[model samples]
Target: MMKASDLLVRCLEEEGVEYVFGLPGEELEDLLFSLRESEITFIPVRHEQGAAFMADVHGRLTGEAGVCLATLGPGATNLITGVADAHLDKSPLVAITGQGGRERLHKESHQALDIVHMFEPVVKWNSQITDAETIPESVRKAFKLAEFEKPGATHLEFPEDVADEDVTASVLPTRPRVRRPDPDRDSLTRATDLVEAAESPLVLAGNGAVRTRAARRLRQLVEHVGMPVIATYMGKGAVSDRLDASLLTLNSGPVGEAASAMDRADCVIAVGYDIAEHDPKSWNPDRDKTVIHVDHEPAEVYEHYNPDVELVADISATLDELRERLDSVEGPEWCSGLRERIVEDVSRKPDADEPFSVKRTLPYLREAMADGDVLISDVGSHKMAIARHFPSYEPNTCIISNGLASMGIAVPGGIAADLALETNVVVATGDGGFLMNAAEIETATRLDLGFTIVVFNDDDYGLISEKQVEHTGEQFGTGLTNPDFVTFAESFGIEGHRPETWTAVKSTLEDAIASDEMVLVEIPLA
Candidate 1:
């Protein structure tokens, strides 16, 4: 008879999970042993939260379900942020956590809590597998649910005793892959008519478009119609950056001209469009305009505004149908004007002495990296600064946590970036944001990833503080006087330095990138 813990490992192998991100614990010791013996790579992270975040990145990069493991009580709670992030961002994830025995679930045992209900609201589905015979089935079901339409995280709680119990039942049967939505021909024809009739047509692709694997087909449809396309923040890399039709790709701030251009379009085609990231009141066209939404999941299609034509089908299939029906469109100067506006916006610079001068430093950074650099921005004004100003010639080179907006995400995210690129990794993080996850610096140094980190020291949470000053006329809990991050990095067995002026910043950045050791460059804002 096999232990439930070994069965869990076997099940993971059967499901094609390549990596398990987690921190081992007493309750999960048996499972950890099983993991070590299995072929799956177990990445032990310093914090359970960081482990979950690393899994989040895996899902975003591979379009497959990310797996995370945790122990009872504190372990499960620590993963809340990352789980919630996956839920909100619609990333497929599985969280297997140890819990108090089934007998001690309601009673207070050491490290005991209502594990099932704790994650119920945030996860798509959650369950506790008390019976050894049922462990395989329950976990398999959790996986299936996580991979379902509008993918999200799923939680499964397994007790230490149950995991060590003998399995008397047979292996659980695998569920067939769920089918994608079928295209409605009538709706497709109507959408095609809308596209053909409109002169200045624009397509807005969202994160859903990227998740659905429709980027290639979306590009084909754009080329077929010869129309310009704009992307939501999470949709930044939906199409290749070097493509002619892609214009003004950034996550936030006023996309005034791009919004105006979208409004001018007689028809707006939204592909796998999820409206969570966009400002509802200001974005999109007037009520009189037509909207054709093509989404793989029907729920996402009508989550916000109702479309004139909603086609529930695979995004690529719908785009192919539209491409076959609609004639080649030539919009005189619509795309050209949008391109010019982007160029103008790129040229816009901040005034001297502004504390938030990260934007001003972008052109030099872009020139320094050229096309090979992989830039990861931490959550803050600095992220917006890089998005608005820094240029990228390739897709997926500019990494961001658009879904979670978790400050201090850059260190771990940058580590992942280094893993992917194996060279030329740069992290631009703000002073306040860096403190939130500065501990990861040690992880990078131990692994010898040696990526360059540029700390933009504004001495405050510039984004929130700036907004509060403007709106409330009072400063709150946003300001800070940072210690020497350079010394901090040096203590962790890494090289550290600070640049005093703009010229120093340029020189330091160039030198840091050239170094073989991990380098930290702290720049004082204003």
Candidate 2:
């Protein structure tokens, strides 16, 4: 009998999914058998959470789509963090989980829980497949929803009985829908007029611009119009930091001359920008300005501040049209002066003498990492520092948890890098975040994945501590007395090192890069 699990594998193969990250369980033996018979290479993970993250990175890296699988109950619950991370970041992922027979559902059966509803908000689409013939169609629909307009995760809950049932009906593969966002010509004219009239113009970009392959086009648009570029956290790498007049970072205090100039500018061009994560009050308050918002999605254009003119169009097309419309008008010299001022607002050094200063540490770490090296960062202030200061010479080099902002993503995300790509991978995490996925160190060793894990041992949860300090005048609920991380790594049969100085960090990193085994390097902070 041809089972649903076999049809699921056929559907995955049809969609060009070459790798499957997951853990096998008794409940999913039928699926495992199907996986073994298919062309898809299933990499077993020590934990389901690790499998989920591995799938996330694989999708982020290849641009195809990520796929992950897990057994029923606990395994399904463990994947929530990774699933939510993909959901928040808009990464296209297809997640599958096993369930008990439909008859056992809600009967106090073993390993039975409502996984479909559990993943509802986190996934674009979710459902339970009780009918064997529906497996192929469900798999196809899951991938379709996952790859839809704003790519995100989609899931299918496969019950045990359904996996063994013979499929009397066959469903064929189908291509997913591709969205086309065309720009409004009239909106472009209005935006171009505002740009021509303004003395100082600033371009604030967001992740939306990067999603549409508008990075190079954005740079050309900025350069051609002679406007300074400022990127949100997700938009950090949208414009090259090395490029002249590129003002990306915005720190509190006094708005540097460049940022201050833009803050006070008469015109702010938000290109494919979503101000969800940015502090817009600081950027646009007290200014009599016209905001020309260009976005592929109109909802993104007006979700925050009302735009003077909303250009609902494809980001690349709108920019191209704007270039055509503004050919005769050129920005003034004040724009160049503002860029210099904004650069001054940025902090070149650490604000305080903390043991592991992010300001000072990032530049050193960037130097140690080779060009095209992949850095997977755990969520914290440290990740923000790396995003602002670290230079990625190539695309898709820096992978962080932007969506869902999962803490322990660093380790599993790094493992995914090792599994998918042969490049050197570095996982940087705070002491607190590392503890979340610390057990995955065994997964790394067992797989013999050669990647480096750098634990920023602040001995406290610095992100939460900073928030507490700001809210209460004192830090609370932040400290964590961690065990010896080096000893823990050594116990797992992985090499471990703790560096006391910046020089030692580089030295240990060099050795780790040369090793064919996993290495844990701890950097203790005061």
Candidate 3:
């Protein structure tokens, strides 16, 4: 009879898992040994949070459920932000945690917490394996639900004693992938009628629209109908920003042409749009505009987002069906100059000629990066610039941690992107966001992972400070000091540089991208 931990590893291997990012602990000793002996590579990270973030990005990019492991109590608690990020961002992730024996669970045992219960609010599903025999089904269910539509996070708690229990294990077969049911013809007809009747039917795309299949169909539909498209923060690259119809990202608001287009629109075709990324009220404040919601799942109930036509099906198939129903359509007359103005608004150089300001530096970075290469943004003021100015050509290429929008994801997310895509990854982080997981630089060096980390130093929590200045005419409590980032990178045995001028910035970025090695570039902000 095999031990339950071995059985669990076998189950993971059967699912074709390539990597499990995590930290090690005594409670997970048996499981660690089993994993060490298996074909799956276990990437030991500095913090449990780093492991979870890496898994989150991996799942978001690959569609397979990314896995992470942690010990009980504190280790499991540390995973909350990243797992919650996975849940809210709609990334598929399976988090495994080791626990004390069932005997100690009822009492206030050391390092024991009711993690499964704590995780309920964040994960789609979860369970604790009380009996070793339940491992197969429980593992299967966790992976299944994590990867299912409107995909999110799942969790499994493995009791230490159960992991040590000896038993004959049976491995459940993985279910074959299935396409979602097609949208009803009546729903399509309703959507078609709404599109035909409206004069300016703009497309408001979200993260879901950028799924590879859906992105292709979305581009096709956009061209066929000639509608201007505004992607959400997470949907930056669904339609190529180079195209005339693509209006770049939509957030709370932009002052000029983009806002005008939104206000002028009578119909909004929200494709694979998730409310978690952006509120509909920002665009449809009056709740009077007709909406055609196209996604695999029903829209989340909200007062401002009442869809006149709900086309629930596989996102790609729904777009194909909608396009086939119409011959040609026209967007608002303002669509011609929308992309140019949006680009200009985002790309104008900073005042005082600060070379490394997000607005000034983004164009250099974008010009250096290939269309398919990746850029991961951490939560900070710089992210606003990246969201607005960074032009992405492919889906999942411009990775932003929206929803929970946790800091410290850029570095780990870049690492995961490298592993998942085998492409150059550039991570953009502010001083505040970078320090949150700066220790993970060693993780990248340890794995010999290649990516670029660009740290924008403002010596304060700039985002909050700027808001404070806006409201009160002054900034406070957001100021901070920093060590030399170049030296910090060298300490991790990686190359580092600082570029003072725009020319050097571009050349340095170009060199870094071509080098394909771990490098950090520190840019000072004014």
Candidate 4:
């Protein structure tokens, strides 16, 4: 027999949890001790939100469900943003929160706020642990649901009493691997017929296509039949931007070169496309184009997104099955010019003497980073530019939050990406977003992690400011101030560089990526 906390930790080990990012508290002291005696490394963070964001990105990069923990009430409340971000982005995550003793849960209690109830809307499943014997099944279920099809966040609330219980429960054995259902025969045949007959057939890939096997078959489908492809922001690297069949990443909803491709195409093969990333209403406002929806589940109900052929099964298998049915097909005639126009809009190099802008910096950043390097973008005006201009050559390399579109993810996400991938990570964040979780710098530095944080110092909330200007012809309540960024970095015991010229920006990024320590490069935007 052992303590329930120990059993809980063992259950986590069985699920292959290597790290648990969280902040410690009084209520969950037993669990913390249990973690110490186990092999799983507990990563304590400055803020619960940062811990949650770290878990969020780790899940997105690795297929496993990233785990996070916190105490009740305030701590659990702090994690809502990142958990919600994971839910909307479809990243698998399992969040755990500690509560008061079971006796006081029904009455007034310290640090108690019905966390299980609060997390209802954001997670797929959530339950409070009342019995020690239930730990094994609870942990297994949390992981299973979070990592399965249409993956998202799940939650568990462990009361203080439950953690101290003595239980003889053993960790559950790993279950047999069950393969996902294959695409239906008739639906797939109909999909092939549409692709074969349509004058212009396009593949609209999303976040779901970035998985290794799915992305491989997607590229094969594009090659076997000369199909045009347009990726949503989160799906940037689903297909290599270098391919002739690639049009461009879908930036804004109804504008730009990518939208033009949607207009020209007669059939849209939405392989692994999630409506939350880029709503079908944006591309199919007219609801006229035939959409061949291929995903793990049936399409979400929407007037504009009605699919002609719903291939509800394994995405990689569906793509391969569809590829086998079609002969050589032709791409849209407008592919060459559409790609060129998209490239020309953002690839121009600004003279060092000219003012800095998001457009000017991307081409240089693209050149500095290798095709395999990872870039996790925090939401702001810069994200729109990165989505539009930055060309990703590999899947899961360029990460973006299109569903929740959360800010302040860049820093925490960078830390998680570095740990998860065991490689140096780069983050693109604006001034507004950087401050949201800026304290994570201490967390990253303490962990001895190597990464580059490129802060676009605009001294304002640029995304909101730009929108306000477009509507009212002026910006209000959008402007803000900042300290000297270089000085700020020095205070944190890390190197920070503020580049005044385009040449300095180019050299700083290259040098930072080469270094084996944390570095911040601040580019002042005009």
RMSD in order of candidates: 3.1, 3.1, 1.6, 1.5
lDDT of 4 at 349: 84
lDDT of 1 by residue, 366-410 (tens): 656747577878889888766655655544566666666777667
Candidate 3 per-residue lDDT over residues 366-448, each given as its tens digit? 88889999999999999987887787888889989888999999998988898988778899999999999999888888888
Q: Over 4 Å off in model 4, which ranges?
A: 211-213, 252-255
Per-residue alpha-carbon lDDT of candidate 2 for residues 1-526, written as tens digits (9 for 90 to 100)? 4777888888889898888888888779999999999999888877888888878877766666789899889999998778887877767889999988787786887777888999998999999887787777788888888876567798888888888888866656677466566676677777888888877777887766666667778877877877766666666666765565466545421344535655666777887665554646667775467888888655443333678888876678788888766753345355556555434434343444346666466655666677667888899877776666565544466775665677878888887788778788888888888888788787777777888888888888888888888988899777879899899889988888987766776678788866767989888876
lDDT accuracy of residue 491 in candidate 3: 93
Which numbered prediction scores highest in TM-score against the true structure?
4
Q: Which has the higher lDDT value, candidate number 1 or candidate number 4?
A: 4
TM-score of 3: 0.97
lDDT of 3: 0.88
Once superposed on the true structure, which residue ranges of model 1 sit more than 4 Å away at CA?
Answer: 168-182, 250-255, 299-304, 347-356, 369-373, 392-395, 420-424, 501-504, 507-517
Better-scoring candidate (TM-score), 2 or 4: 4
TM-score of 1: 0.90
Residue 230 lDDT (model 1): 75
